[model samples]
Target chain A: MAAADKVDPIHQFQIHPIIPLHIGGYDVSFTNSSLFMVATIVLASAFLYMSTASRALIPGRLQSVSEMAYEFVGNMLRDAAGKQGMQFFPLVFSLFMFVLVANLIGLFPYFFTVTSHIIVTFTLAILVIGTVVVYGFAKHGFGFLKLFVPHGVPGYLLPLVVAIEIISFVSRPVSLSVRLFANMLAGHITLKVFSGFVVSLSAFGAVGIAGSVLPLAMAVALSALELLVAFLQAYVFAVLTCMYLNDALHPSH
Target chain B: MFVTSAYAQEAAPAAAEGDTHAGTAVPAAEHEAFPPFDAKTFPSQILWLVITFGLFYLFLKRVVMPRLGGIIDVRNDRITQDLDHAARLKGEADAAVAAYEQELAEAKVNANKIGQQANDAAKAQAEGTRKKLEAELEKKLGEAEASIASIKAKAMKEVGTIAEDTTSAIVEALVGGKTDKSEIAAAVKSASR
Candidate 1:
């Protein structure tokens, strides 16, 4: 309650529906989160589209960025899952751009972070796990379960190893979603808290205002760190997606 | 209207705070649970994520990937073609150098052969001229020797006659006479022998 005198660090995460709507007994109202998503889609898609519109042999700066994004995701997928994993290229690319754009856009003041919500990240994580499951079974049938069975384990320890593998497997989506959400939430909160210190500190007197620079400096440093996190988390999400898809493609190993 | 209301909601809390610290002014929608964990927004966020992600996947797959990949493929193909062209030219250049060297070597051999023939011809001509001069000098020396022998024989015969005449003159002057010419010739012959 003492923090009430300061900015609510949680204020930025609030989601009030911009256009309240009811669809099939669901509160599917367009919230600020949705607006940011729309913005992300438009911006990412437009960047790719316009940047490569000319498709120049020697690309200009924007085109180079777009191309690097393509290669960066492409190489990450290829390295993790091998050439055959390229089938999930669209899925991986979409997830990377979506998360990346959303996080970057959220860094702007008062913009809702779509990825900071558990449901959003969970949905993405589930989608990746879901794709792995569906595609694994569809492609490899019962052999997909071989993912749990090790190649050269003693029969005595095999049961324990399999149990651990299964537990780890189940935790993948949880970890994936929580990692992104918690990082963004914690970073944003910490940043807000620092800025809050500056605000609350300045109110005391002339000396207080001058001393607020410490927290202000901390906030600036935190902003730089958050920028790194923004990109890194997106990359992490995509990388995990690729690894999961790898499981689908080669469930035996 | 939505923006205005949201702005109004944001302004209300700060206005009530009396202190002008707008930095900490809380949002209007204070939840019983944390805002992020609030279940009410789940459906909307999930719905939008699906719709947005689904649409995003489609757009990338259908549009972006192909175009970007097209340019890359084009560039790669162009590079490959250029390299192949360059390699071919290099091969051609190497072949040309090889041919030039071979021709130079052949020309040198031809020049050597021609020079050898010229040297042999000159040598043979000089040998012929030397042999002709030697043979001419040999013939001239033989003729001169034969003439000398003939002249010597004639002088010997004349010397016999002169001996007989001198013997006759001496005898006639000193010892009364030109007697015994045949004997004098015999004497002269005996003495010359």
Candidate 2:
């Protein structure tokens, strides 16, 4: 198809079924997104296994990296949620590793970015928010509602502040999901657009080929920036999750 | 520019035809409006996500995380044990040094006492020898003085006898009679004094 040949920047994000299957009239087909997700799991599991296998007192490079990751997330939780928050280390660590690995793997050429999809990012965001709300309610009962009400607010300003707090609280999943999804989507699109410019211009003549250099350079720069963004977005997601959990644990503000 | 623009325009119609063909290939209704925006694929994505995430969570909780935690715990315990062992060794070394110092001090005290005893013994020995030598010298001097006194007495008696004899002979020769021996002795003694 000519559409397939034409450089569609959005084409890279298309979810084609690798194993088309239907279950109960639902399209439960295994897609490229699913494949990459499984790949992420395998990669993450392998890394974790290799790093922890030796368990040396004097850590090797891989073990040190693994330990640093552990402590990095550990410290983030401790700062945001205190000692009591350590109980959720498994969940928080899982989120951090999964997101970080997914983001990193997506950086590879021709790889699908799972986190770039709103559905996927939204699911993760929902999971985080869900955990916070469920645990908050379970732990604090109705006092979890106090999270919407800040201390030291004047009576007249209380309603407006409370409304604003409630709105922001309700929109946590949206903002969290959009932050990651938009970053990846925008970065990937920019990279694709620049790369497409190079291709399109090169098809034109000698002058076009020389002009393509600028876009090629831009693509290279964008890729490096995307790598940084990939790490930063994952970190932001984890940190925000930790903050949300902290709020749940201490519902006073 | 003209050739590139013409090529792009030609590609556009072909792309539109390609889209129609692709649309029909998959059921038109089932076609993803936009792949990411398609609601039809949400269920499958969510379903797989849940399954994968759930399995991953369990794996991390049961296998990976626990192993990591155990490794950290073991390393910490080892570090603590090593520190404790080092402290114990240091304490032992300190005790040994203290004991050595105490023994050294005791030996010094004993050495000093022995030196003092030797000096006193040597002084007493020298004093005894000096006293013995002085007594012997005094006895010899007393004997010599007694002998000299006796000799002097004998010489004085002889001198008196000779003086009486000589006086008697001179008196005879000079037609004078000799005086008594006792009287001559008294006269000689009176003259000598």
| Best by the TM-score measure | 2
Q: Encode model 1's per-residue lDDT on A81-149: one tens digit a residue.
A: 999999898899999999999999988777788889999999999999999999999999999999999
* lDDT for each residue of candidate 1 in B69-175, tens digit (9 for 90 to 100): 89889999999999999999999999999999999999999999999999999999999999999999999999999999999999988988998899888877888
Clashing pairs in 1: A6-B24, A7-B24
Native contacts recovered, each model: 0.74, 0.55
Residue B124 miss distance in model 1 (angstroms): 3.6
Candidate that would win on DockQ: 2
Q: Which segments of candidate 1 are over 4 A away from where they belong?
A: A1-6, A156-160, B1-31, B74-118, B158-193
lDDT of 2 at A79: 97
The DockQ of each candidate is: 0.33, 0.38
lDDT of 1: 0.87
Interface RMSD per candidate (angstroms): 7.6, 5.0
lDDT of 2 by residue, A1-253 (tens): 3433345666667666767778887777788889988988889988998988998888899998888888898899999999989988888998888888988898887899988889999999999999999999999999999999999999999999999999999999999999999998888888877887888888889999999999999989988999899889988998999999999899996
Kindly state the fnat score of candidate 2.
0.55
* Chain B TM-score by candidate, in order shown: 0.58, 0.60
Cα deviation of A132 in candidate 2 (Å)? 1.3
Each model's TM-score for chain A is: 0.96, 0.95
